[model samples]
Target: MFTIQQIDGAHAKVKTGADFPKYIQEIKELGVTAFDFLVSNGVEVYYGEEPFKTNSPAKYDPLNINENLNAQQFAKELKEHQDGKTDFPYFVKMCAINGIASWKVDLEEYTCTYFDLEGEEVLQEEIPGE
Candidate 1:
């Protein structure tokens, strides 16, 4: 179960669940007001000043995992891994499949915080804030 709130005229808050397909349909009808979407889909949202770096191979990546590994084998592998490791990549892959290319990080305190590919905080001294 996920909750969705239409905050402003440009953005909408989206959570993840079985209701996502429905939520997206609603948001499309209602019109999103916020830029970031304030997505809290029970998945740890990563923040960066710029867009996420997507690989070319990942761009045309097939959604059907059975092509590489059978469904049962994929399920077994996923069950063995810990949380937050494979989950994010899986979510990214799903987003990509749906043509959701870029995502922005909306931090209340630091609106323009920069993060490296490894998701580490980077401070710029010449940026006036630092």
Candidate 2:
């Protein structure tokens, strides 16, 4: 089992999306099997083995998530963020504005999935890592 402090310490190294893959790798090594991030307030729920779970407190003020899903625009913003053109907070705010309610990353599958306001999967991408 891992604590939120440990996870947050690893996450603090992620200044931009370009740093995400490495962050995931570090946390994965910390026993985080999966994690879900709520876009509105930045709370995260981290999971490990059976019965191992921890929740992170909200990091930012709540933002209104747009009801309309703008997949195309979201994709564009995602690309820019992945390129390190924007910071993490900006990327999160953009996700909310584009109607993303949350996102989940599965360490075992090495996949990251974004969800819409209605909890529908908006996009799923393989995480690039060693």
TM-score of candidate 2 versus the correct structure, residues matched by position: 0.98
Model 2 CA RMSD to the hidden true structure, in angstroms: 0.6
Top lDDT hit: 2
RMSD of 1: 16.5
lDDT of 1 by residue, 1-130 (tens): 1123232221232232322334334433443221231112222233223453211112233333112223343334333332223443465454333333234333323232322233334321111121
lDDT of 2 at 120: 95
TM-score of model 1 (CA atoms): 0.22
TM-score against truth, every candidate: 0.22, 0.98
In the range 1-130, model 2's lDDT, one tens digit per residue, is 6899999899889999999999999999999999999999999999999889889888988999999999999999999999999999899999999999999999999999999989999999999995
